[model samples]
Structure formats: C-alpha cells, structure tokens
Target: MQSMEGSNRTLVVTEFIFLGFSGVHRGQSFLFLLFLAIYLFTLVGNGVIFTLIQLDSRLHSPMYFFLSHLAFIDICYSSVTIPKILVNFLRQRHTISYNQCIAQMFFLMIFSATQCALLAAMAYDRYAAICQPLRYAHLMSRSVCVSLATASWTCGLLASTIHTVLSTNLAFCGANRIHHIFCDAPPLLQIACSDTYVNEMALHVASVFVSLGTFLLVVVSYIFILSAILRIRSNTGRHKAFSTCAAHLVVVIIYFGMANVNYNRPSAGYSLEVDTLISTLYCIIIPMLNPLIYSLRNKEVKEALRKVLGGLKKDSGLPQ
Candidate 1:
C-alpha cells in the first residue's frame, strides 16, 4: 500500500476526487435541482443588483458603489464552485484534476478574502454615514471609494498568494481523496505529505485576519451605527437609519456566522460531511442569499430597478 506521506521516492497523487453531496446518498437528482435553482437565483439576483447600481444615477453614491462591487464579487465567488458542483451532480462524477483543484482553491480564497475586506469597508461607510453624517460624502468620495476597493482586492490577492504558495510547497503524495465538495484549505492540508505544521500555522494566521479581525471591525462599526440610530428623535428617522443598515446587517450576520462557524472553531474532530454542508452555506447559500437581502429589502434598490426596467420597456416600444 502506498503510504499517505509523499516521499521523494514515490509519486504523489496527481489529482483528487471530490466526494460531493454523494455522501448524502440517494436523491442526487433532487440535490442537483436544488443547487441548480440556487445557482440560477444567485446569477439573476446579483446581476440585477449590479446592473441597477450601475445604471441608476441616483445610485451613484459610495454606498451603492460598494454594494455593486460586493454583488459582483458574490457572482464571481459563486460561479467558481457552483458550476463544477452542478456538473458533477448532473454527470454523477465529482472528480477534479490537480490543476483544476489548485485553480478552484485560488479563486475561492481570492473572492472569500476580498469579501471579508469589502465587508469591513462597507462597515466604515456605514460608520461615516451614520456616525459622521456631515462628512459622509467627503470621506467616501470617488477617490476614496476607489482606493478602498483597490485595497480590498489587493488584500485578497496577497492572502491567496501566500496560501497558494504554501499549499504548493506541501506535496500531496498519496490519498488523493479530497473528502469534500471543493478544494478547501483544511481538507487539502490534511492530505499533504510534508510536515503541515507550517501550512496549518499559515491557515490559522490568515483565518484570524480574515475572520475575527474583519468581524470585530464590523461589530464596532455597527455598534456606533446603532447608537446613532437610537439618538434619532423621530420614528421616521429611526426607520430610515435602520433601513440603511438592515441589508448590510443581514449580510454581515450570514457571512460572519458561516465564517466563524467554519474557520474560527477547531477544524479537528469535525466530520468532512459537516464541513461540506457548512462550506455549501458559505460558498453557495450565502452568495445566493446576498442579492435577495440587499435588493428585495432595499427600497432604493427597488426603485432603481423599477426605473431601469421602465426605461427598458420604453426603449423597446419606441422602435422596431
């Protein structure tokens, strides 16, 4: 039997088999349809928000600008993995090539980390708008928004680079089974032949930054935002203030909840099956839910969408 460790004397497994929802047994078709629906909704929901934000001049503010970018990231994040899972469900095979596995992991890390930073940026936006309303416009000006977005992306790239380089250094000499639906970090590290203490250390360090650090920043931002809302004298003022943050609050809850559950806790002793389900929530379900939370709950977004659709209808009727 080949040892789990990849010695220089032996060749490591060149590929990995994704044991997707196959663990659930039976109803593969049902699960396929379910995820297919989720994927489709993710596409349309995020797409609508992105388009509405771009087209509506009223939505050109910094808050909507950041929301548009967040929607775009959600689209990319969900696309990277859901399509593969969908294909696997349809074909009854959940295998991925080693190179594909690496690519998946890279994009997943990039988008996931980017979202963490973007959430923090959004928190600051709320803090400025609510806590320092006088300078919200000046603080979140076009140049500042651009810089924040650029930094968010740069952080994601840097984090992904470190993880990918470290992951590549550790050889997966055998036991090609990935034991999950995607090329997640912990599961992949488990199969590495080299001493993975370094890899685990890096993973924990990055998780700390991306998970707890961002969560704390958001919590602080919201604390001030809530205090500001409480100080408002009028009912309409309170409602408006809460409305401005409701979508973001829901998103933060969903995102940080999944992140804390998955990364903040000890990965030890957890079943791969549980990991897969939780991964699906963060990777699939949250992306699917974000657009709905933001678009449906937001009256400004709804109005923008209505105007955009009305314009399209008018344009379609004007000429043949």
Candidate 2:
C-alpha cells in the first residue's frame, strides 16, 4: 500500500519478495535440484551423527557431547533457511509475510550465534584435552560441559532476542522486496523505511561482542593447544595430539571464516547477487559440509557410523 502525505510517498509493506536468481529459469531449476540434494544429505548425515552420539555408550564424553550439540545446531541452522529457499525455488510467488520474515531472521540469528558459542566451547574442550591432558577429565567434567552448553544456548538466545525485537519494530514503510534468498539482517535492513542507524549500531555491537568475542576465545584456546602439541617430544605423540582436534579446527575455520566475512561487514550495505551467493555459501554450503568434515577426519565418528550402520543392517536382516 502507498500513501501520499504532501509530496512524500510512503509504502506500508506487509510482505517481502525474495528475488533469488529467479530471472534465470534454467539456472533456477538446476539450483533447486542441487540444493534439494544437498539439504537432504545434510539432514541425513547430521542425523546419523546425532543418533550415533545419543545411542553409543563409548561416545558419551565431553567432546562427543559437544559434537552432538553441534550436529543438532547444524540441523536447526539449515532448517531455518533451507526449507524457505526450497519452497521459493518451487513456487512462483516468492514472498514471505512480515511476521514470517521476522521469525526467520530471529531463528537464523539464534542458530548462527549458538553455533559460534558451540565452536568456542569445543575449542576450550580441546585445549583442556591437549594442553592440560593430566587434568583433562577434571577440567571438562560433565557438569562443566553441560554448563558451557547451557551458557552458549542462553547467550545466543539473549543476543538474538535483543536484535529480533529491535529489528522487527523498525518501520517498513518502504520497499517490500528483500533482495536475497532468505531474511538476513543485512538485506532486511536495506528496505527499512525508518532510519537504521540504531539498528545497524546494535548489530555491529552484537557482532563485536558475541561473534568476535567467541572467535577470539577459540583462537586463544588453539594457541595454547598448538603450543602444547609442539612441546610433545615424539613425532607420533605430536601427530596424535593434533589429530584429536583436526576435525574441529577444520570446522571452525570454514564456519567462522565464512561467517566473519558475511556478518562482520562495514554495514548492511551489500550487492544483491554477490550477497546472495556468499550467504548461500555461508549458511547452506557450510552446514552441508560440516558432517563430511567431522566424519571423514575424526576416527571415533567414523567407527560409530560403521557400527551403527552394521547394527541397522543386522536388525533388518540385510546383507552388508
């Protein structure tokens, strides 16, 4: 709806259009299939990890506990954006209601922030295990692991709630089209009718505190871990120590590296095509790759998957 007050024209936008590579009909069809396959694999792969962690008694350790949480977060993080993107891929009317858009933005923030905290918590777990091996069990007690996981979830929820409430309250009496695949803060803020200075500031502050702060902690923990790994006398010992966290390090580098590039920008200002590609890579591509990274690199996860699949085959009386 449009209203003219004096010479000023204002629009009351109740919905947002998602213009995600829709112009390229053949390309859109190909992308839809590709993303569908990727999303399915992501769900199946992470689900296997989550289930194995839950059911396997030998996997009931601090590291596996955090791995389970990370897997759960991957499922959630992908769910927040992938399904909508998929629906938009199949549908002609690529639109989302204002409330739906707000909800998507809120949950996306929660999952992304929570995953950052999870990565940090996992890093600290590795630091304790590698740097302070003697006291590893004592330091990463079950209670401590639970506390860290709880704190991560709480912090993410708190951070996202602040932004979601504030961002949703912004006046959207302007362009109704969101120029990206999903509702992200940067793109959503682009169409805001109200001045977004305060919203942008809040986002920047949150990025600094929650995203950068957690990442710095991860970095520091790794520094100590690397120092400890280097101090190992035997080459085999060093390799073993480093192997314990190689999977996690790979995950952290990919997840946080892309996130920092996307979120820690100068402002919400971004090119639509470039922003969409990068966001898809950050949000969709990374989640799909995490299971592959962890399972392929970590010995424990591979064994657990083997045993789980073997048991399923046995239960079904199927030849393996």
Candidate 3:
C-alpha cells in the first residue's frame, strides 16, 4: 500500500497488496505444503516429459516436438506465479511491488498465449498425421516445426507486449489492492483508478484473437481429423486414429474450458472466492495436469519414461 505523491497532486501506488489469502485465518501451513507439493510435481512431471522427448529417438516426431515445447512452457508458466504464491503463503502481508506485479503479468500472459497457440499447432500436427499420412513428413518437417514454434512464441510476445504496455499506461493512483490471486489484466483493471476502456478493449480483442481464435483453430483441425477418421473403413484403424488425438483433444477441452470460465465470465454475480478458485485451477492446476494427461494416455511417453527410469536404476546398481 505504499504510495508517492505525484507532480499532479495524486498519490501514485508503489506496491499492491493481494487479498487472495486474507480470509484464511488458519491452515496457512497446510495450504503452503499443498501448493509447494503441486509446484514440485508440476516441475518434475513436465521436466521428465521434456527430457524423455529429447532422449527417445522414437519420440522425435512432430507431435513430440510440439509436446516438448508444451512441457517447457508448462514448467515456465507455473514457475512464473507459484513461487511467489508459496512465498506469500508464509508472510503476514501478501504484498508485491508494482514492478514485480507488471513483470508477473507480462510473463504470465506470454506463456499462456504461447501455450494456446502451441496447442493449436499440435492439433495441426495430428491432423496432418491422420488426414494426410503420406504428406505428413513434408507438412511437419523439422523446419516447419521450428517455424510453428517460433510463430507461437512470437504471437505470445506480441500479445503480451500489447497488454503489458497498455497496462503500464494505467494510473493506479492510491488504489493498490488486487482482488485476484495474481497480477492478471482483469484484476489489475478492476483496481485501476484511471480509465480502463482501452485496456478492457485490448483484453477483449486479445481474447478473441489469442484465446478464442486459437480455440477455433483447434476445433477446426479436430473436425477435419474426425472426418478423416470416419473415412477409415477398418474399425481398428479408426480407433487407432482417434486414440492419437484423444489426449490432445482432452487437453484442449480442459485448457480452453477453464480459460473461458476464468476469463469470459460476467464481471457480476461471481464472488471473489469463486474468482480465486477458478484462477487457481486455470493457472496452478492445469500445468500440473498437462504432463500427467500426456504420460498416462500415450504409450510411447510411458515407455520412454520407463526406459529412462530403468537406465537410471541400472546405473545406480539397483534391482531391475
């Protein structure tokens, strides 16, 4: 809640206090442990997936290429917020400096938007594999994958730059309290004393192009994939084709569904507690689940994980 007097005779906020944990009079330690455990699991799970993809030659295809990037993004996305949250859980005041808040918001948006685009790229990879197996090699060459990954990151950077730049222009005055868990655009907008019409419009536009737009891309790719799968005369062929997409489809549904709930909800009628819960699910829980979903659903990832574990066990002279 620190503020400085500006030349315009207005108080400028120097920091923000988070009210996310204000209601908890007890169980701080329990919450800390829970969040820490989930953060560690997210790190390890996604780290393992990335490492396995790098080590396993069988997993060097376009699908796994995109998956490795996804895993990397998950690790980064979770790290951007969870570490600060864990630190705040132990402190009496959940406070963040204004600069830190901006940084957090920037990185958070970058990773989130990148993941959305990356997921769409992965869907296209699946579509190419299933719908046009013969041309899959050319459609998903190494250069193509690199370009897609680069484009995803570029989109994220551009979108984040727009939002972050717009956000910096907002005058916080003396209102330095953030209602939500993290330094997202919406929460910051809610607390800004200045006009936020431009910010809100930017957010809505980014939502359409980055969130909803990527979601529609995924949906369209799946439609073509489904039609392609249906064309296969053999039942087993259809099942195999569908199985390849099942994991990514589930991930797309969960990510976009939670995103819509977290972002697209009406600003009224929802309590702060509900907002906090949805943010936790969308930001904290989803990253941890992504790797688990992929590992559990994909036989190749599981096999690669087993091989790595076995190699480690053998190197340590442990029982097979």
Best by lDDT: 3
What's the ranking of the predictions by lDDT, best on top? 3, 2, 1
Taking all chains together, the TM-score of candidate 3 against the true structure is: 0.97
List, residue by residue over 1-320, the lDDT tens digit for candidate 2.
Answer: 55657566666677889876656676667888988898899899899899999998889999999989998988888898888887887878788888898899999899888999999999999999988879998999999999999999998899889889888778877687777888888787777878888888888898888889999999999999999988889999999998999989998988888898888765644676777788889989898898898888877888888898899999999998
* Candidate 1 off by > 4 Å: 1-8, 318-320
The C-alpha local distance difference test score for the whole of candidate 2 amounts to 0.87
lDDT of 1 by residue, 1-320 (tens): 24344443666666788865766668888988998999899999999999888888999988888898899999999899988887887775678877788889999999989999999999999999999989988999999999999999998999888988888887776677777788877788877778899878888888888777888999999999999999999999999888888888889998989987866557563677787888889899999898878877888889988787788889889632
lDDT-best of 1 and 2: 2
Model 1 residue 275 CA deviation in Å: 1.6
Model 3: residues >4 Å from true position, as ranges? 1-8
Each candidate's root-mean-square deviation in Å?
2.7, 2.0, 1.3
Candidate 2 minimal-lDDT segment of 10 residues: 1-10
